[model samples]
Target: MERWVGKVAIVTGASAGIGAAVVEALAKQGLIVAGFARRKERVEELAKKLQGAKGKLYAVKVDVSKEKEVIEGFNWVKKNLGPVHILINNAGIIRNNTLIDGNSQQWEEVLVTNVFGLCVVTREAIKSMKENNVDGHIIHINSRSGHRVPNIPNINVYPASKHAVTALAETLRHEITRNNLKIKITSISPGYTETEIIEAAGLPKNNYKDIPAIKAEDVAEGVLYALGTPPHVQVGEVTLFAVGDKS
Candidate 1:
């Protein structure tokens, strides 16, 4: 943590949930944290609350699904804040529809936001890190669905997008290692987190209430642990689940 003080970090989907929690945690550790989200006002409100913290928080309007917005956001960070030292790819979405009867638009939305968005951000962040010679860390806020499909219904293409993320993490890791770049990549998968994403997916309230769930801050703690590790140590993947969660 001490090593990262006064450094720069970017957290996507930072208006709420896991992304918000990660932003707060990193900022408290004295890093210049940038919170990127479509709902820029929410991040601005959060930044106000974080006043007098160990580090500063900057709220940037960015829809990760948009390539132009992503590029501009990174450019702003580089010109204003400095090169990026850490990137937490936490932005994602879900739709409650089955494949056989699912709306293609819903599936596309899920894929664009959860998969393509992550890739764009990673590419831009890596460019900054490599150009500036920063041995940074990249974390994907993946889901248990990335590893295995839950028994729940109507998850649609959400799980498939996550599985792509799972593979992307490894693919990026190999690419970085082969290039002799010191950048580290990790995939943190959490099972059934208590976040708005579930509700937004249109799951019944009773469904999630009956299941074991982890808090967003718990997942943030995992990110902290990963970032706090020695430079030589790279946590490849971390899967988190509530104690009683069967899946």
Candidate 2:
């Protein structure tokens, strides 16, 4: 929105999929956006293409799974771009395995990336916002599985991680209100989306092909809708999926 023009926004896991789309949209809205991902070159490449947009995009190489790296990335953003006005916690991962006999390493990876990583980034971003006395917004890109377990198999601990996101948003909201902070927290859960996550998770190719899905851009639009509202109007949660999606 015009109110946040020239302000700073951070999008994690921003090299591709939902993260990429969200960051690009924020940049075009005139926010100084930073796209953080381990595949820094991918974000940098996109940044190059967005050079003529209303705002600037910076690519920061960060693997959100590590706390030290996350801290450093936040420091860079603070020192260079002032404080965070918006934060899109979009970094997440899913492994194709069942919980009963699933690979422990894979589950650990998912927990680290989806749960712990998100918390660390949020802490830093909220810290920046509080320190600067800015009323910022934090949006968590969750999944429908967070609300209900899907019928699909081998979703592993993905749903559990997302459920944590659902609880986290509420907890953060409570904390904000108790602390008398003006910050807003929202969780936007999207159903099966067309993204590299499916392929990267090694889901069955045929299943992905048959599943009706929404575009990553659609989720990005929902994010903008949340950010476009007035400060007093806190858009607590949004759930979006393709019309034909039965899941």
Candidate 3:
């Protein structure tokens, strides 16, 4: 955390949920954070609440699925906040459907946002780091489902996208090692977290009330933990779950 003070970080899907939590936590830790989201006003609202924090938050209007938008956002960061020292790939979506019979449009939407969008963001952020010679960290906000397919309902292609994330983290590490880049990759997989993604996907708020769940702040703490490690110690993966979470 001391090393990252005054440095810059970018967090996608930052308007709310885990993304918002991470933005607040990072800014409090003294890192200039850019919160990218389609609903820019929400980030701005959060920014107002952190008026006197150690660092600042800039809201960038971006829809991650669009490569052009993502690239532009990175450009803004480079021109203003300097090279990215940290990238949090937290923008993702899940649909309220099933594989046996699901809406094609919904499936495509999920894939484009959760999988392809993540790839584009990672690519641009890494490019920024390499060009500027910054030893950065990339944290993927993956789910426990990424490692194991959950038997929950209406998850549709979510688990598949997350599984892709699991592979991507490892693949990125190998690429970094082969290329001699100092970038570190870590996958923070949380189980049954209390977030709006599930409710937005048609899962009623009551469905998981009795079941175990963790708060978005808990995951944000885990992210800080991974980032606070010594430069030579790369925390490859961190899995967080409530005591009774079955997922």
Better of 2 and 3 by TM-score: 2
Q: What is the lDDT of residue 102 in candidate 1?
A: 79
lDDT of 3 by residue, 1-247 (tens): 9999999999999999999999999999999999999999999999999989999999999999999999999999989989999999999998888899899999999999988999999999999999999999999999998999877777879999999999999999999999999999999999988888987788656656766988999999999999999999999999999997765
| Candidate closer to the true structure by lDDT (higher is better), 1 or 3 | 1
Off by over 4 Å in 3: none
Write the residue-wise lDDT of candidate 1 on 129-242 in tens digits: 999999999999999999998877788888899999999999999999899999999999999888889787786767666679899999999999999999999999999999
Give the TM-score of each candidate. Answer: 0.98, 0.98, 0.98
lDDT of each: 0.94, 0.94, 0.94
Candidate 1 residue runs with Cα over 4 Å from true position: none
The C-alpha stretches of model 2 lying farther than 4 A from their native spots are none
The alpha-carbon lDDT assigned to residue 190 of candidate 1 equals 96
Candidate with the larger TM-score of 1 and 3: 1
